[model samples]
Target: MRRSILSAVTISSLVFALGACTPKPDQADNAAESFLESLSSHAEPGEFTDNPDQAQEEINSSWDSLQAEGLNTSLNNVRTNGNVATADFTMDWDLPGDRNFQYQSQMTLTKTQDDWTVRWQPTVMHPDLGANQHLELRTVPAEMATVVGSDGAALLQPGTRYRVFVDTSTGDLQSTMRQVAIELDAMRANDESVPSIDAEAKAKEAEQVDGEFSLLTLNQQQGLDLKNRMSRVEGLRFNEEQAMVRPDPNFAPDIMSRVSSVVEKDLEGSNGWKVVAATSEGSEVRELGGQDAQTAPSVDVSLSKKVQDAAQAAVDTRSDAKVMMVVMQPSTGGILAVAQTQKADEDGDAALMGQYPPGSTFKILTAFAGMQNQGLTPDSIVGCPGTQDIGGRIVANYNNFSLGNTALENAFAKSCNTTFAQVSTDLQPGQLQQTAKQFGLGVDFNIEGLDTITGSVPRGDVMLERTEAGYGQGLDLASPFGMAMVASTAASGRMPTPYLIGGPEHRTEAQGEDGNQLPKEQLDNLRRIMRSVVTSGSGSGVASAGEVYAKTGEAEINGGSHSWLTGYRGDLAFATLIVLGGGSEHATSVTNTFFQNLDGK
Candidate 1:
């Protein structure tokens, strides 16, 4: 009986010891899940480990070292034996380039004081990660794409150019930069193709930089020509690398620069850089186990080489003042040519962005408004006096020229300011505004690779303001491109929406129809009046270009006036502005040259 009782007691004690040593499977699973969830949450370190602050600090440091979009973890197959537990888990990281990096890891836990706790380690996230080691993302940039003009001609090509630099860390950087600048200036003085260098500015810029700093960029030919001279200078270094190249140095610099500048915000999804896993020191980088980078497609523009060359030459020959010219296809609204002289280029892209008084150019819309609202035809009788007081302001024609009791057609052909001003008093409010909208004035356009400004026309409330608007003066502002569209509208009898890139399929929807907005008969009458201007009035100088219809404007400014001409020949429409060119006659001369050259006459 005694032996039996002793054996029973021993068995009971053995069962109690085993129960204390082994942990339940459900408890181990709960601990594993809590540990994985804690990775992305703010769980207290003591809740999962013995070393509270150290474990928290380690987790925070690991997370901070990694650059990823997001992280996900899941635990499964949990098992426990004695006081130890193990769980199989998967860790997935969402990275750039639409990639997901995944790996399997095992988590270990221990039962302490009747609670299951996870053993914290960096390897829990990544098996290979060690102390002072972390995961990093490295991006490999894709090859740049070229820009092609009409007919697959290369407009911008990727090639190698030279950069002149000064070694700031090694020698007298400022003095070296100044010497290089002097050499560049001397070369530029003798060679027109060499770009200018400012010695003082170069010295100042060198002082703000460290190590090797670039002073100027030169084309391959230019760099080769100056290599011997540049080599003689101390502390000057020449580095050659890939850069954007153009066949002609100044072939649409502003527009091409916008296309070649690669930035993060504008990078297309399929053509973007690839993100990869790398060591903390960025020595070994491996693809996040994903596909390679895709090739970027080229961009095609609508610029015609013949028209652009001709337009550029015509503007470049002018030494008197700034000039800008724009050419377009009236039917499709395709911008074929945009040219500006050096003087105009210094003032930015004035051909597409300048805001100047339209002068007599606005008369086109005013005439349409008059016929639509006041029931006036092109032949309606109106008086053209030398000077007339209109709503407390005196208005007159150019040089106070006038013809008494003249027809409206003659007044429009001669650009009589007083006659249009008088006629403006008869139209209703917003009449001119409504008419101008039909001609694409005050409308926004979205061209793929171009920045532009159309024009603006205010609603004149008082009689004087209204009268001023009638002759294109009061609060009427337009760019050369805007006025070109106006001419296109008159030619095609539809509001023209211009585009610099893409084809007809990319054009924006029409704003409004000409026939729906303005009277068809009146439009025909306006066309005739424009033809008369070229045939018998201020625009007569350009009439030799063959059936050309045009309007001439001398917009009055502080010093003098800006010369303006908007016209069309056959299917082509054009606009030109000579900044402060004195009178409409100069604009007429520019128009003559443009049309004469356009027709190769």
Candidate 2:
């Protein structure tokens, strides 16, 4: 009985040791092979793979350093009662070469009959691409129309929709009409308000009606030519719109370019309506949308022959420039007639798109910030040897000459950089950036395709550079649109929200409900200074038509210069930028031309 009991004890001890030696199924899978299968299934094609040997080699090659870099893997939970089991694990590692990026992955795997499988949400995992990443190019609720200004009239009109009959072999007018009607019914069912034309009736009647597309004649070859003209355009197509025919071939490219943009697209089309591809210059035939569908009421602008002659004269002499001559109503800010040297359709880049250095024009902003934030006065005296050392760097006045001892007015009149830089340093650094933001610098304009660059003030070496930068020297960059905002803000005394879209618009909700966009007091402070500049300061070179408030700037660089002028005449605010890549005289010359024209107008 003693020997039997000893034998049982020995067997029981052996059984316990065997159980301890065997691993849990989950622990066996978590050893690295399972991880390779799980990661490879979900990884992008370029980076991760399924081969355990390869993965081990990659990790092993850098294992010692990776271990030091705190690369870790942790197993959280494992269940293995049934044939299928679940394992949860996490991997954390620093990317090899890139310090800026760190990766962490949590994986949960379900054991299949033969292998482990993973589930991933591609949309959530990769948000930067796939269907969710793109902005849908949706069709507008209704066909988009255009607002056009001609003579003195502003016309808003709906566009025409036409289907050209290129092949007579396809059908007669009645059959084509029937086809058009069927398609029209189908289109209306899909989108309730699609407009359709009666090709059969139009072929019979031939009268041009308002809000209706007229049937026009085109041969098969003519249709092919038209299609070729419209090959590059998408969304809304054109067989025909308005056409201008000129005798001179040289003028055709210019005319075609202009007319193409104003053409409207119809709702049913795959491409926008545009000019028929043709270079013909005199009395070319094409279709236009009927008058009634237009949004703005068409009115004839009655300009005197004298005004027309003057406009023509302005165009004739300024042939080289891409000009956009805007005549606006000061009281309402309604642009009257915006005439350009090119055709009606080619609205050139300069209209609201041009950008240039603001030069001394920006000094008014520094001056205002100085007075409001640092308790500076217009009469305050600044030591202007015309140059000074700023934080171990020397900054010189505009002409590099001494004004000796000067008051604020004299310093401003002389466009003194030293005074501006000193003032910039005295004010809080944050104040300059904040004030510029307040005036809409770095903000996008509502106008499509135009970018407004907000000027930046530097911090360390850049900051000292920006002290001179305030006068448009170091790190000063601005768009004409941005400069206009600054000028308008200074002119109006409140930070005026500038818009290319015109209106007697009221102030935003952030301001008081009174729609007093600018404060009377702020306007008073800036107005006096700007008026002083226009009359007797740096801007005095430009003759003012009335009580014009302005400032002129000259930015000199290593090889060239950019000149600037921004000001307000009555309620009309404007900013001009010119770059003359060589002599300083060229910079001033261009500015003087604009000023001369502005004064004459």
Candidate 3:
């Protein structure tokens, strides 16, 4: 609002009116347009403005702070009142980055002696633009949205991460790395939520770098602890950044890290800009106009917080070995959880990509091959000898344990190596390989936001190789992810497509569209046999939890054996593995604890 104040003044000199005719309305409009053109060009308008020199000075002084690219003006309307006229015009300000600011304001023009001149005033720039004021553009960033899980629970939110690194100049690099891991572990024990690092890999990478190399990125509390504890350590540095992070540090840290890398750009929306009227002192007076930024949408993942916590806790029980467990929903093929202990993290997501001999778990495929090719049934009698020679290589049961002659179901439950070895030897090459793919093993899923490699089943013409492959001894390999798929196929009859992200554009599609489906009756019989393994055989450790179906295995490697268990209970199909964890009982115990914890919840 404009106000008028009364003040008494004495006239110093008398002025005489010029004998000139009033200019037309068109002349006023044209003069007003010329004045705007002068403002844009930062120059004085000749003979078109009452005070061109004063307007030129105001244009340069007021608009200098705007840093505008250019200005455009259009005359809206012009009203004539004898010698004085009002011209309403709109100004379009071209700003940086293809942005524009537009507003309507009015200017006055005086007519005398057949000439119309624009009368200068701050209001010509903007209606609310005050004296000694100019327009300034400022950009404001929008807030990132939360990343939710399948249950609509928050999985990740906007947060800060501090990357800590080490300089190789530090004395005794290996000893320093060991100490760093120890101190970091101590800090994590205090919070019980900090994510763990691959210390051995981090050390090896640092050794290859010249000056400094990053070790790990920690959440807020973890970073603060590092500063308080290790800031004084020589050759250590820290850098921080705003990032999307998991709320529960203990809930699938490594998996969530991978998720963040894929969804970060989508979560950060476009930035908004506004034009504000400011005084010469750069103090904002009022907002002229601007657009607001669109709200950024949240990301959704397939992880269940309750299930992930349970699996993570189950694996954390033993920190001695690299224990990993992958759980899947057979009905929808959603990845329920990918949990690994700190020791397992050192192997860089071995649960999804690491391949190892599956031991007796391979019997699942061998048994299916027998049923499909040899027309065998669960009630069919099979030989379970202590030791048997098939074409040259000798296949023996664990400690040469013999069950004599037994039903196929009982032999499967007992994980009879000799019996399955004989069954595999009977089938031709590529038969087991085809059966493996039918069970979702050895098939590439090409999942989005996640990289995975299913296990491998070889096609060899040699009888000994086929015999060893039957018991998962010679050239069979399966990752936890692949084994989990096998268990899912067993439960669902056909292999369900796996996906970590829920949206179709960011999801894992059905890559096995042309893959074979398991025979229903035979699969039912297999499921029954797998249940018996849990009911009265090798998987008895988890029998108390529920009607869990499973196959237990201990593949003998160089130093020790890899514990393996793959099966399903209800909608949850899973595979648990422990590298060099000795026996399948260790994997079974972990699975039991996982189920117990889940059921307890």
Candidate 4:
């Protein structure tokens, strides 16, 4: 009986030992899965590896090389032999563009300390990978995108341009180099944005080169102009290459400057947008892998070529003072033209960026405010004295000329400072600001690929400040573009949101819902007053354009006056600013000329 009991115990102990010697398939599969999970999640590999730190370093180096959005791995056909175990695992990489890349890799797990652990090796990622070899990424440049106009014409096109080079081996080195620099400066004198070349730097560059040294790249027209002049001069050569070109070199350079280049640095790591290739550096093993780079789509703008050319010609003729002219279509709010001339005081895009008092031009908003808040009409009687005083400050009309006791229409038409100033005292606080907002003044704009300053009308506290605000002075400031919209609002009844790109989709909403649209009655009265300005007031000079509505301003500054004229001719609403160009008379003359040229007269 003792021998039989001992045999049973021995048999049971042997069965338990056999179970301990062999690990279940689930245990080996779980261990392999744990290692892959750690790698995919960028977690420490200590739980499933012999050397956790080394395994982590290996994973860190090879992870980005995969270049995948997601990695899905599964263990299949797992088998174990003695202390060594093997599993055939399939790895599926979710790349960009709904594409998938898959490969089969064998995982080797060793039994250590009675636990299954994956043996770390570079070959675990790919069978061909070596210890020193690492994956490298390369980018291929995509095709360039074109900028198109509203007419569906290519605004910018790929064309040949020339870069001027100097042969250091020939000619008078010092004299020729200096003359070349002078000629380049003369060519670019009209554009203040162009940087002047340094003659000393050119000389140094010439010394460093044995054969040919490049100076500057120029457009076809620019190169052609310089080629003839430089042909007679020695050591000059022209190297031609393909580049982006516009129909007119100065055609909206500010707006086009924001367009992306073909070889853009910003698109380097953007998946699917750029072509990415994986390569092995040391082993000379390379695989061409990545989605083909997509060309950037062209942008269509609302600029009118006819209007832009005319405006450019008018502004380009002047070299005396800074001039900016902005034209917009009242019905559609499409910006037709933005033209500026080179000047001594020119800083930036003055059409959208400059801030100056609107002078009498701001009276449009003042007159609107009076109509909205003061129950005043075109026929309302108002006193227009030559001068008036408020808070110890004297306000006078242009040259102190005023028609005493005239209708409000005449006061607005004649731009009587005293009449408007006196009426302003009756306005409630914030009345002028509310009126300005209704006219699209002091409203923020978000035109794509463009920056604009849309006038500023601060709240008037005292009687004097409110009175000044009435006549477009004393803390009232606006841009030519902003004033253009003010004229457009009066023309269209509803204040049209100005846009250069994407049309109505890019229209900027007004600050307040009340300011979005004006009453038709108010706009009608405003139109009558503006028309009188052209027919009988300061803007009579532009009357030849036939039934024109206009307002003229002479904004006072340190040295002189900034002449401003804003009006609409037919479907076009426009604003013109001549920086420090005498008074409204100068702006009036420019306006007349602009209209005549616009009509092809």
TM-score for all predictions? 0.67, 0.47, 0.80, 0.65
For model 2, the stretches where C-alpha displacement exceeds 4 angstroms are 1-152, 155-355, 448-462, 500-522, 581-601
Worst 10 residues of 1 by lDDT: 4-13
Superposition error at 236 for model 3 (Å): 12
Select the stronger candidate by lDDT from 1 and 3. Answer: 3
Which ten residues in a row are the worst by lDDT in model 2? Answer: 5-14
For residue 454, give model 3's deviation from the true position in Å.
2.2
lDDT string, candidate 3, 271-327, tens digits: 887888887777888877887876587877888887888888899898877999999
**Best of the candidates, TM-score:** 3
Candidate 4, residue 532: how far the Cα is off, in Å: 1.3
lDDT of 1 by residue, 111-198 (tens): 8868988886656656765654445554555555666776467777667788877777766766676666667787777655578777
Question: What is the TM-score (0 to 1) of candidate 1?
Answer: 0.67
Question: Per-residue CA lDDT of candidate 2, range 34-67, in tens?
Answer: 4433333323221222334433333333222222
Q: How accurate is candidate 3 locally (lDDT)?
A: 0.82
Q: Write one digit per residue (lDDT tens) for candidate 4, span 1-601.
A: 1111010000011121355467434566667767766655556755577667666666655556544465666655567787788867765655445565566777689986679998876567665555654433334456555667665767676677889889989976778778877877887776533435788878887888999888788878778777887889888888888777776666777666653242233223333422222234423464434456666666556787777777877776666778888888888787888888877236787888788899889888888888888878999999888888866678888889969899999998888988887777678878888778777778887776678887888688777788888787888999998899888888877778777765344455545424356777878898999999988888888888777899999888788888989989778898889888877878777777777777899
| TM-score of candidate 4 to 2 decimals | 0.65
User: What's the CA RMSD for each of the models?
Assistant: 11.5, 24.4, 8.5, 11.9
- In candidate 1, stretches whose alpha carbon ends up further than 4 angstroms from where it belongs are 1-144, 150-153, 187-194, 207-210, 262-296, 446-451, 503-519
Highest lDDT against the true fold, candidate: 3
How do the candidates rank by lDDT, highest first?
3, 4, 1, 2
